[model samples]
Target chain A: GAGVSQTPSNKVTEKGKYVELRCDPISGHTALYWYRQSLGQGPEFLIYFQGTGAADDSGLPNDRFFAVRPEGSVSTLKIQRTERGDSAVYLCASSSAGGYNEQFFGPGTRLTVL
Target chain B: AQSVTQPDIHITVSEGASLELRCNYSYGATPYLFWYVQSPGQGLQLLLKYFSGDTLVQGIKGFEAEFKRSQSSFNLRKPSVHWSDAAEYFCAAAAYNQGGKLIFGQGTELSVKP
Candidate 1:
């Protein structure tokens, strides 16, 4: 893809439901990132992937939030037992050609937990 | 833990007026700095970034930012902002060796008045 691509631009799920958000980073990008943005706030880091390994997951709020990039190309963010407080936009980004490169973002998935 | 702060929660500026948005970071090292803009219901677009070299770095959309090491600040500026520049702007910082996981500040909402 020319840029990072995300699927299911908008998602609505009831409490206790599970949801998965997908991201397809640009070809050859070595790094990927996930973030969540609440209303009237800045985006918060959730996770990061370098190659097939998760380099950092410290920013993830809790056990309910999980993400994986199996092949290092496509990644998925899963939320279990969704809560109304989980309602926010999930953003994905990728950087190519190594260190200090700028990240290109996807359109993002607007997840609304009811 | 690393973090960022954007002081002004909301700012209104007339079209063609000079614009400045403040950002401060708390990090052990001189971290990589960035500014991103997000329009209504859209993904974030990178405005500019600072790594090494010059303290002042140029970015897209006619924006520039200066990284002050002692102050731990990276303030974004534009000589004249357009009406189209009305959006939410985010300031972010990440460690160079931290695998690209970014810590972002609370955004500044810019409302450009014609």
Candidate 2:
């Protein structure tokens, strides 16, 4: 089966610009998650969605980071007023229902804000 | 409040040597533990997970992990590592909530010296 897929394998933008990263989860996957990874560091949780609603968003760094999965299939992470600190790889993952299931990840979107 | 620690920033092992990556987590109660691997220009892939039951868990690609409650650790190990195993390894923790929010540690960069 096809695994999770993220678009815009790489993105370069100026500071204070807006950016949107897209993710297409595996078919029939009901859970989706977003994370960020900086250089020499592990991924940091950003948000999670169950079905069409956000199940948890406590990990989102700030209001500028937002995600939506209206149809519970594809998701988009939007960043407003991007800063240099936001330069990192944005990862998307999908999993079966439940808290203990394993997650499948995408190739990730590398965002570079100058 | 929940966090993870990967003490080893980088480790080098021979092509046919045993490998172990340490992971420690700080959570209020029983936590879901997981190990993931990422290669360059790729997404994070799950190696193993431990929620309960047997402390020892087997995973994909000849990987395994042991969950030790006494030490609040879930360490990944392999009896013999191949050169292709060189990559970044991440240990993460997730609470039992439906949200499945994860806390990841700084990854360990494994290099195969052969």
Candidate 3:
């Protein structure tokens, strides 16, 4: 089976610009999550979606960051007015609906805000 | 707040040598622990998970982890490591109450020597 897939494996943009990262979760997965990984650090949660609604978004750093999963399978993480600090690897993961289902992760999209 | 800590920033061991990577977590309640491995240019791969039942959990690629409630720790160990095991290892805790988002540690980089 195909694992989670992210488009635009690498993206470079100027500061104050906008960028969108896409994620395609495994087929039939009901939960999707986004995370950010900075250099020399582990991934930090960004947002999560259960079905078509975002169940928890407290991990989003600020209002500039938003994510949506309209069809319940593909998710897009949008960053408005990106800053240099936003440069990092954006990871996407998906899991089935359960108490402790293992998450399958994508290769991630590396965004560089210069 | 829930958090995970991997004390070792980096470790190097010869192929076929024993390996141990320590992980400690802080959470209010019984936590769901996991071990993930990330290779360069790849996504995070689940090595194992501990939700309940047996304290000792075995995983893919000859990896295993032991959960110690008395110490709030979940340490990964392998009796003999292969060169292919050289990569970054992350310890994470699932926030089940908060929509199953993961809280990851800083990660430990493992290097294999011939």
Candidate with best lDDT: 3
* Native interface contact recovery, all models: 0.69, 0.85, 0.79
lDDT (Cα, tens digit) per residue for candidate 2, span A1-114:
899999999999999999999999999999999999898888888899999999888879999999999999999999999999999999999988847788889999999999
Lowest summed-lDDT stretch of 10 residues in model 2 chain A? A95-104
Q: TM-score, chain B only, every model?
A: 0.97, 0.98, 0.98
Off by over 4 Å in 1: A97-99
Ranking by lDDT: 3, 2, 1
Superposed Cα RMSD, model 3:
0.8
Quantify all predictions' global Cα lDDT against the true fold: 0.91, 0.92, 0.94
TM-score of 3: 0.98
* Residue B99 of model 3, lDDT score: 66
By TM-score: ranked, best first = 3, 2, 1
C-alpha DockQ for predicted model 2: 0.78
DockQ for each model: 0.72, 0.78, 0.78
lDDT of 1 by residue, A1-114 (tens): 378889899999999999999999999998899999888888888988889888889889999999998888899999999999999999999998445788888999999988
Residues B1-114 of candidate 1 have per-residue lDDT tens digits of: 788999999999999999999999999888899999999877899899998999999999899999998899999999999999999999998898877777889999999999
Clashing pairs in 1: none
lDDT tens digits, residue span A15-66, model 3: 9999999999999999999999999999999988999999889889999999
Q: How would you class the docking of model 2?
A: medium
What is the descending DockQ order? 2, 3, 1
Better of 1 and 3 by DockQ: 3
